[model samples]
Structure formats: structure tokens, C-alpha cells
Target chain A: MRLQFILSEIGIGLRRNLSMTISVILVTFVSLTFVGAAILTQGQIQKFKGEWYDKVEITVYLCPRDSTVPSCADGEATQEHINQIEQVLESPEVSPEIREVMFESKDDAWVAFERNFSDRWWFTEMSVDDMNASFRIKLTDPEEYQVINEVLTGRAGVEEVRDQREIYEPLFDVLTKATLVASGLAGVMLLAAVLLITTTIRLSALSRRRETGIMRLVGASTLFIQLPFMLEGAIAATVGALLACVALWGGVHYLVEGWLGQNMDWIPYVTTGDVLMVAPWLIIVAILLAAISSIVTLSRYTKV
Target chain B: MIRFDNVTKVYARGARPALNDLTVEIERGEFVFLVGASGSGKSTFLRLTLREEKATSGRVLVAGQDLTALSNWKVPAMRRKIGAVFQDFRLLPNKTVFENVAFALQVIGKPKHHILTTVPETLDMVGLAGKEKRRPHELSGGEQQRVAIARAFVNRPDILLCDEPTGNLDPTTSLGIMRLLDRINRTGTTVVMATHDDEIVDQMRKRVIELQTGELVRDQSRGVYGSSR
Candidate 1:
């Protein structure tokens, strides 16, 4: 029976402050959407790392016929130079770091170069004689690129050692920084949501001061008097969270999955499942925001 | 029953004490009037019994529990045993008469069946039986006070505290309110009323405790408003 009274009180309070309640809902919705976006962006970064990191390779380029480097001053790499390089790769000192090495001859490099730039206007300016043969070395751990670089640098016929991860680092760095920016925005918006909820509850409590005074005089417990106001905030925040979840789901399903996935098939994108995974946390955060603000406001405003 | 032992209430720093170092006691089932001019501390006295204000130097005990020593969490339980009526009637303006009265029992978690039965009975006793559906604004001043009275007595409290319950009513309405209070007191509930109405005080001829500028000046059984002074 008391629960019925409290529930009815909550309804009355919401109705009495409908505009303020709507504002709270909108503020919470916008804030939690930012929170969901930040979480999903982090998830997207993890997906990218998982998909790309294992396939990265380190390439060791051999000197070309016209090379000017001191290590390659002996002119185009000889068969002996190639043999010595293969022996070093298979040596016990470096074999553990190297998963497998495929040697690409100048002809093979020329073919790949043609296939890549065939559509460009400068295609005819490059030829097989200008192409440098290279060893494509896959590592057991992509992070162990430095060990191979240290062993191969300045070696006979070796012109340059390049880790593929370096090429991808700037892309990943941009993404990670984007996630940080989103999280920073989310933090500011959440603070605004908390303050709006606090003010809404304070106004509600103040408007009903006469009723609250009577309730106090009639022996209503502090919790009993404050529950209706607290529930008012919780209900608004919960609705906002629900709206945020819907917005996130639509964004991930249509924008990320449908548009970005179809256009950029090679890049993995966050799915609706990721949005679902973050939904509960969003709702929990909303409730926690309401609960904390209500506790702070009610403590000062609803004292018997 | 209520007891005050050298109770003093100081509301602010460097201001006159609201209630001076004074002592008084009223036994169970007694109907007493606390009569004083404004600022004589009549409301403070009621507040002390309700545990709304902490006495600076002394103790207040109601229904055998030391209010000063009671923990904050236990105050609601202490107040539940006491019914209070105010000068403004203090009914929820939006709630119907029946809802206003039923609210008291509902807040205390009374069973639905008990509320369904007791609310109408209490309304009848306050002469607001058929007017249960009316809101506070829809009622006359006396009817509104009756609703307040019904809400106070619905839970069958051990003591009823009134702070100018008839202050806003005409003489005839005030008399009706006093008669209702007398009827509730006749049911063996202790009654403490604070009022400045001389005619009601003289007519009721109950025990009167008079305060003059925070000092207890008189206490008399079967007394008129200023007969003891």
C-alpha cells in the first residue's frame, strides 16, 4: 500500500514538472549518446588492431644496380650476397624472431609495382631495372620488428629495413586520439546532465514544500518523503537512457554497418552487437547520475 | 503524556531564547492549552514535543521516550505516536478529503482494508462524511479543519498536538473544531493545544499554561484564558 502511495506521488511529481522532466530527459539522452559513441569508438580501435596487427610484415630492401649507399657500394646484389643474407635469416640468433622470409626478386617486385600503379599516369616512368629485390620477413610477434632491424641494418646489399607497422601507426594514432576527444566531450556532457538533474529535483522539492512540511508533521519518514523526488529523477534518466540506446543502435546499424561496412569492406566496423553491449552500462550510468544528484539535492532540500 | 524539564530553545546566536529554562508536565488523557502572545514560545513548545527543535539545555520526553536522547532515525516512529494539527489546516490542496485523511495511514503502511474502513469512520467523526470527495479548496474553512483533524486522528495516535488549529476559522467554526478536539481527547488521547483565542480558552475551561516572553507565568486546572494571571 505504501508502495502504491509512493508510486502515485512519483507520477504526480512528474506531471507537475513536465517541462523540467523533459529537459532532463533530453540532456541525459545527449550525454549518454556521447558516452556510447566513445565506448564504441574504443571497441572499433580494438577490432582494427586485432584484424591488422598479425598480418603486418617487415621488408628488407636489397641494393639496386645504381645504389649509392656505402653498405651497397659493391653494386647490384650478387648471388653470394643473397646466400649470405638467407644464411643470416636461418641462423639461430635471428631465426626465433623471424617467422618466415620470402625473397622477392627484381622481376617479381616489378610485376607488383606495375599492378599497383598501372592506373596512374606515371606508370610508364618505372621499369623492372629500377625495382629493388627485397626479403619480406614475417615475425612471430609484430612488436619484435626492432630485433630484426638491428641485426639486418648496414648488412651487405641491405639498403633499408622497414616495418609495416610503422605505416599503420599514424592511422591508428589518429583513431586513438579521436576516441580520446570523444571521451573528453562525453565527460563534459555528463557533468551537465548531473547538474540539470540536480536542479530539477531541487525545484520539484521546493515547489512541494508545503506538502512536504505536512508530510513531515504527519510522521512520514525521510526516505518516504524523498523517494517520490528521487524516483522522479530516476524515471526521467531511465527514459533518456532508453532513447540514447535507440539512437546508438540506429547509428551503428545504419551508419557504421550499412554505410561504412559496405563502402570500406576491408576495414572492420563496430556492429549493432557492440551497441547492445554498451546499452546496459549507459542505463546504469544514467541511474547512477540521477541517484547521486538526488541524494545531494534531497539531503539539503528535504530535511525534516 | 508530555514532559519538559528545564527545556530551553535558542533559535539563533545573540537572540532571545525562544523557550526559557522552564519545566512542565501533563499526564495522559489530559487536555491542556498553551496560551501566549506571539513570540511567547507556544509554537516552540509544540516543536519541542515533536522533536523538530533540539532544546539547548534541557530534555523533552513524550510518551515516555526522551526526545533529546532519541536517535534521528527513530524520530519518525516517535512522531507516529503523536498527531499534529496546524493553524493553516495543512491539507494537501490537490488531494480529496478522503485521500488527505487516508494519506496518514498510507504513509505509516497501513493495510488497504484497514484504510478503507477507518478513513470513512474518521471522516464521519470529524463531520466530513459525505464530503470526502471534495478537495481542500472546495471546502469551507471549518470543513478544511475537519479534514485536518480527521487526518491527525485517523491513525489513532496517543497524543494530539495543535498549533492554532482554529486560527483561521470564525468563532462558530472554531467552536466546532474545539468540540471535535474535545471529542478526540475524550477517547483517552492526550491533547496539547496552543491558542490565543480568549473565548475558546474561557469556554473550554481546561488546564491552561500561559507563557509571557519565554517565561512560564501560570498553570491552572479548569482555568480561563487569564484567570490564573
Candidate 2:
């Protein structure tokens, strides 16, 4: 009847069955850790996609000035060919698709290449005249890059078209699949945890059969007899969830971000700040998982 | 008052009935001793009054409610009006003596103030006021049984069904318990004790019902414990 009395009984029940209580907590913590890992990994993948998608451009490298191809027969990109490409980019139909465009001359391309590969010997072999100038186009729709590529390629001065999305797709695919695998494993573990929790509660009930029988004989309601067992499970689950959130937070912050940040700075936005941003969600998920499993197990097994 | 009309109870998958075509009546404030050896339907009769086991083919009425027609959910409410003492004492071992007696009132959702007053009063009534802090295991056999009596009488139930309340005590201790039951009976609580202590039954000279092989052989007021002595 009193909240304090009920809670005290729950505490006693948990203490009396310490091993089973710890088992429930550990099971919940492990399952929720997997769940938290899956969620964080999915968030990281999304963050990478958003940052890379924003900076990614369609780079159309033109024929070289000293080439022997039909596009470069004039020994350089002709003014008339440049005018035609600019006209197509400025057109109302194409303007809506192309958000912004920038041109790189041969000298600019050589300078960029030199800056990128300054430590390598390959860059010393290429002169300014050997470099191919290109137009970098930022598209309005990342998914519609194929339409822009079709319109640009085979034009007078364009030699090749490349979309960066195709280059990094396999990596994102693997991360996404890893998320699915984690979630599948978590689902199975959670189900097992529920069954184990139920068994634990049933065992607790059996151990205190005399107390329960006495309670029933004295006119204690079924709910009154059952609440302590339910509280036992819920408390264990909640403790487990709390443990999981801490474990996941440390795993993401100290291990993944700490090790990976030092090795890979080229990839932007893979930071602990982002992981901490979703830490509250992990805690909520842990508590919810514990609460749900507790309710389900107690309702089924501890019916006084 | 309690009444059983041709009450018959056959346990699951059992050919013979535990109580066969039995009829009995107990008036309010009456002290009745149900005497029989083991498996003689003494326990079955007490269980039927508490609605723990139902009669198979007859009507059982306790305090004006038909045990057969009452829903399972209403059994607890019905039991609240009756007190039961078990042979094992059934005191919650983890609880202190005070808590064990207080639990009887607490379970029924009695107000905190009422419990604060009534638990001590009931403990005092059972002569267990000074030992309220001790657990059941710390007490002697008779003392533990006294605590159970306190728990039973705490709510002031209209009827008390005790299945071998003195089964575990020595004869001298058994007489003390019998005197306590008699004191409770004088307060208008119908006391039904199922026991085989021939000495107390003969000494009290109360109404006795004898059963043999699940059949009532004798029913008499002021009956001796057994016919032999």
C-alpha cells in the first residue's frame, strides 16, 4: 500500500536473490549495448553521408591542350567550346539542376595536383602543360548526378565525368549492413533476456512461496503479492540499461573516436561530439528496454 | 454462521471423494472440534469453509455468501472475514514479530494509523507485546503459534478455522493454546479447530464431530476426544 513499504520489499527481494538479479541486469546491459552500438553506428553513417554529400561535386576533366583527340585538336580548349558549355550551364533547365560551377585552368590543375601529392615523386613528373583543366559542378540534387553527367559528357571539350558518390558507396553499404546485423542480434538477445527474466521471477516466487501463500490467506490482493517481483525485474533491467549506456558512451568516445580520429582526418565530422549528442537517446533506449522486459516477465510469471 | 448441505469434494483424478455427502451446521460463537485421524476429511472441511477447496456437488454458505456461486476474485474478500491458523504457523520468517502481526491488517489495506494502534493491541492481547522485535525463528514453538494467533485475531474475523494449531507443541503448550482459542471463542468468534489432541477435546467438552474414512460417524455436544478413554 505505501510506496515506501513496497519499495523496501522490492529491495529485500532483490537482495535475497542477488545472483538472479545480477543475471537479469547483465543480460539487459549486454543486449542494450548492442542496441546502442547499432544506433550510434547508424548515426555515424548518416553524418558521414551528409557531410560528404554536401562537399561532393561532379568533376568533368576536359581534353588536354597538347592531346591528339578530336576535342583537343585546337591544341587548347577553344573559346567557342567554352562558351557553349557555359551557355548550357546557364540555361533555365540546366540552371535549376546545377547549383554552382567552377572552372580550373591547366595551371590551376597543376598547382592543385602538386599540393595534393607534394610528398610523392609522381607529381614532379607532371608539368603545367600536361595537366587537364576541368569544370567542377555542384548539383542541386545529389541523386540526379547521372542526368547532369549525361548532358556534359561527349560535348566538345569534355573527356570524362565522375561522380564521387559512386566511389564511396561500398563503404557506406558495409556500415549500413553492420547496423542491420547488430539490430538482428539485439532482437534475439532481448527475447532471450525476457525469457530469462521470467524464469528468474518465477524462481523468486517459488522461493518465497510461503510468504506469498500467507499474503494471499490474509487477503492481500493479487497485485499486492505480485508487485515486488515486478519491481525486482524492473530494477535489474534499469540498472543494466544504465550500465549499457555508460559502456556504449565509453566505447564510442575513447575507442572509436580516439583511435580513428588520429588515423583518419581526411573524413570530416567523425567526432565524439556527435556521439555524445546521441548519448541521451541511448540511455532512454536502455531504460525503455529494461522496463518493457520487466513488465512482460512479471505479468506472465508472478500472478499470485 | 456456517452451513454445509450434502457437501461432496472429489479431488482431481481421484475416484473417492474427500468429503462425501456431508451435512453440518455451526452457529455463531460456537467452539467446535473436528476430530479425525490423517486423511479423514478434517482438513478438507476447514478448507471448504475458507473456499480454498470447493465442494463438488453441494452448497456451502459462510457468513451469508454461497461459496459455490462466489467468483474467484471475491474469495479474498470473503476470506478477509475469516481467520485461519496453520500447523506450521506460517509466520513470514523474514518479518519481525510486530511485522508478522501487522501484516494481517496491512494486507487488507488498513490505514497506517489504524495499523499503528491495532498491531500493538493485538500483540498485547496474545501476550506477545514484549517480543515484537524478534523474528519467528527466534521464538519457541508455543510463542510462534501465539504470534499466529495474534495475526488471526488482529482483524477480528467472525470465524476462525485452525487446522492443527497445536500439532507442533507439547501437551502443556497445547493446553495454553486451547485456552487462548477458548478465550477467543468467548468473544463471539466461531472457532473450528481440526486436531487429534484427545486430551484438550476431552477437557474442553466442546461440540465434537468425528470422521472416519471420509464419513462422519459421530456428532455430539460435550463429546469426549475419543470413545476409548
Candidate 3:
């Protein structure tokens, strides 16, 4: 009987404040959607970081026969100069940091150059002697690039020792910044949701003050008097949270899988699985929003 | 049974007490009238008995429990033993007559089967059986008060406190309500009604406890509305 009465009371309250209830649901839906987006963005950043970091390599470009660099002033890199660089790269002190090393002779370098730029007019102006032979080293740990750079730079017949991270670090930095922006937006929207839920509950309590007074006079406990109002807030917020989950699922299905995934299959993207991981937290946040607002408003307005 | 021992209720410091230092004992099964002019502390007396307001100094006891010392959480249990009616009827405007009377049982956590049997029975006793489906707005003043009275008496409380239950009703309607209260009193539920209806008080000839400026001016058996002056 108590449940029946409380249910009917909840129905009455929701119907009485239909417009405000809708606003509360809409606000909570928007906020929780942002929260899901932030979580998935972070997941995407992690996937890209893991895949690219393992594939990046450092390249040491040796001077050509016509080179003017001081390290190559002795003339074109001879077989002796190339053999000495190879010895240092395979030494026990440096070999562990170097996962794999592939050497390209002047002839090998010329062949790759011709293959890549054959269609350009400048390709006809280039010859095998103008190309620089190089050592390409993939590291076990990309962060230890300084270890290989110190050993190889300014060595005889070497023109420059460069790490490829310089090319990709900026891309990673932009992704990290995007994640931060999404999280910041989620915080602001969550605060708005909290305020809206609190106002809706306070108004509901005020409009039903006469009923509460009568309930109090009939020996109802404080919890009994406040239950219907609390349930009203919970129902609206939970619906918003559930709607957010459905929207996120649809977003990942259509936007990520259908649009982005089809166009760029190699870039590691966040999937619906990532959204599923985030769904529970959005619901928990919605519940906490309702619980806190109910506590704050009912304590003062419906106190027995 | 209700007992007020030197109960002094001061709503604000240095203000005239709503109920001055006064003592009164009401026996079980007795029907009493709490008669006074405006501001004579009749409402405060009922409020203290209900623990709505604690006595500033003295003790107000009901059903052998000292209400002044009752803990806040236990006040609800204390109140269940005493049903309360009001001048305004205090019915939920949106509920039907049956639901309004059933509400009292529901708030106290009664089961569905129990409410179904008791609510209609109580409504029938108060002469509102056939009008169960009507809302408060559809009922006359006396019928609304009957619904309120039925809600109070549904639980078979040991005592019933009515604060001008008939204040807004016509003379004939007020008489009918009084008959119902009399019947409930015959079942051994003590009745304390605060009213200014001189005709009802004079015709009933029950015990009267009159107040003047928050002090007891007269306590007479088989009393009239103006026995002294």
C-alpha cells in the first residue's frame, strides 16, 4: 500500500512539473554525452600512441661524394668509413637500445630515390652519386633516442643523425590536447545538470507542501514524506542517462565505424566497445546527481 | 487519557505564553470541550499534546508517555495513538474521498488488504460510504469534514483531537458531526474538541475546560459554553 501511494504521488509530481522535468532530462542527457565522449577520446589517444611509437625509427644520413659537410671533408664515404660506423652500432654498449639496424649503400639509396621521384622533372636531374647512404635504426625504446644520437652524430662520413619522433610528436601532442578540451567541456555541462535537477526538486516540494503538512499531521516519518519527490528526480535523471547511452552507441556505430573507419582503416579508432565501457559511469553520475539534489532540496523544504 | 501539568508554552522570549503555568487531567473515555476566545492557547494545547510544540517548562503527557521528553524520532509513534482533525479539513485536493481516508493508513505503512477493508468501513461510519469516489472539491463543507474525521478515526486511536472540526460547517451540519464524535467517544476514544460554537457546547452538556488569556478559568462537568460569565 505504501508503494502504491508513493508511486501515485510520483506520477502526480511528474505530471505537475512536466516542463521542468523535461528540461532536467535534456540537461542531464547533454552532460553525460560529453562525459562519454571524453572517455572514448582518451581511449583513442592510447591506441594511436601504442601503434605509432613501436613503428617510428631514427635515420642517420651519411654524406654523399659531392657533400660539403665538415664531417665528410675527407671526400665520399668509403667502405672503411661505413664498416667503422657499423661496428659501433653493433657494440655491446649500444646494441641493446638498437632493436634492428638496416644499412643502405650509395647505390641502394639511389635506387629508392629514383623509384619515389621518377615522375618529377627534378628526378631526371638527380643521379646515383648525388644520393647519401644511411643507417636506419629502429629502437627498442623510442624515448631513448638520445642514446643513439650521441653515439652516431659527427662521426666521420656522417652528415646528420635525426630521430623521426620530431615528425610524429606534434601529432600526439594535438591528440592529447583534444582529450583535455573534451574533459573540460564535460565538467561544465555536469555542473549545469546538477543545478537544474536541484531546482526541479525544490519546485515540486513547494507545490506539494499542503500534502506534506497533512502527511506530517497523520504521523508520517520524514522519509515517508520525502520519498515521492526523490523518486521523481531519480526517474527523470535515469531516463536522461539511458538516453545518453543509446546516443553514444549510435554515434560509435555510424560515425566511427561507418564514416571514419571506412575511410582510414589503419588509424586505431575507438569502437562501440569503448562506449560500452563508459556507459556505466554515465549512469552512475546521473544517479549521484539525482541523489544529491534530492538530499539538498528535501532537507529544507519537506522537513517534518 | 491526556494530562497537562503546569504546562507553559512561550512561543517567543518575553512574549505572553500561549499556555501559562496550568495543570489539567482528562480521564479516559471522557468527552471534553476546550473552549476559549482567540489567542487563549487552545491550539497550543493541542499542539503540545501532539508534540508539534514542546512545553517551555512543565510536562504534557498523553497515553502515559511524557511528551516533553519524547525523542524526535519517536514522535510519529506517539502521534499514531492520537488522531488529529483540523478546521480546514486538510484533505489532499486531487484525491478521491476513499483515497484521502486511505492515506492515513498508507502513511503509517499499512498493507493493501487492511486498507481496503478499514477505509470503507470508517467512511461508512462517518456517513460518507456512497460518496467515496468524489474529490474534496465536489463535496460540501460538512462532507469534507466528515472525510477528515473518518481519516482520523480509521486507525481506532485511543484519543481524538479536533481543532474546530465544525468551524466552517452550517449549524445543522455541525450537529451531525458532533453526533459522530459522540458515537466514537462511546467506543472509549477520548475526545478533546476546541471550538467557539456555543450552541453545540450548550446542547451537548459534556465536560468543559475554558481558557482565558492562556490560563484555566473554569473546568466544569456537565458544563455549558458560558457557565460563569
* Tens digit per residue, CA lDDT, model 2, B1-229: 9999998889976778888988999999999999988999999999899887878989999999999889878888888889999899999888899999888887677889999999899888888878999999999999999999999899999999999999999999998889899999999999999998888899999999998877888899999988666
lDDT (Cα, 0-100) at A116 in candidate 2: 92
For model 2, residues A1-304, the per-residue Cα lDDT tens digits are 4676678778888988899889888888888888877888888788888899889998887877666666555666766777888898898878898888999888898888888987997767877888888888898888889887878777888777889888889988998999999999889878877777777778888887787788778777778778778778877877887788788768866777777766786675445565566566655665565467657665655443
User: Which regions of candidate 3 are displaced past 4 Å?
Assistant: A64-141, A144-158, B5-8, B12-16, B20-23, B54-59, B66-71, B212-218
Relative to the true structure, candidate 1 reaches a TM of 0.93
Q: What pairs collide in candidate 1?
A: none
Give the Å error, residue B51, model 1: 1.3
**What is the docking quality class of candidate 3?**
medium
Displacement of the residue A154 alpha carbon in candidate 3, Å = 5.1
Candidate 3 residue A139 Cα shift, in angstroms, is 4.9
> What DockQ does candidate 1 have relative to the true complex?
0.68
Clashes of 3: 0
lDDT of 1 at A156: 85
| Number of the predicted model whose lDDT against the real structure is largest | 1
Tell me the whole-model lDDT of each prediction, alpha carbons only.
0.92, 0.84, 0.90
Give iRMSD, candidate 2.
1.7
Model 2 TM-score, 2 decimals: 0.82
Model 2 CAPRI rating: acceptable
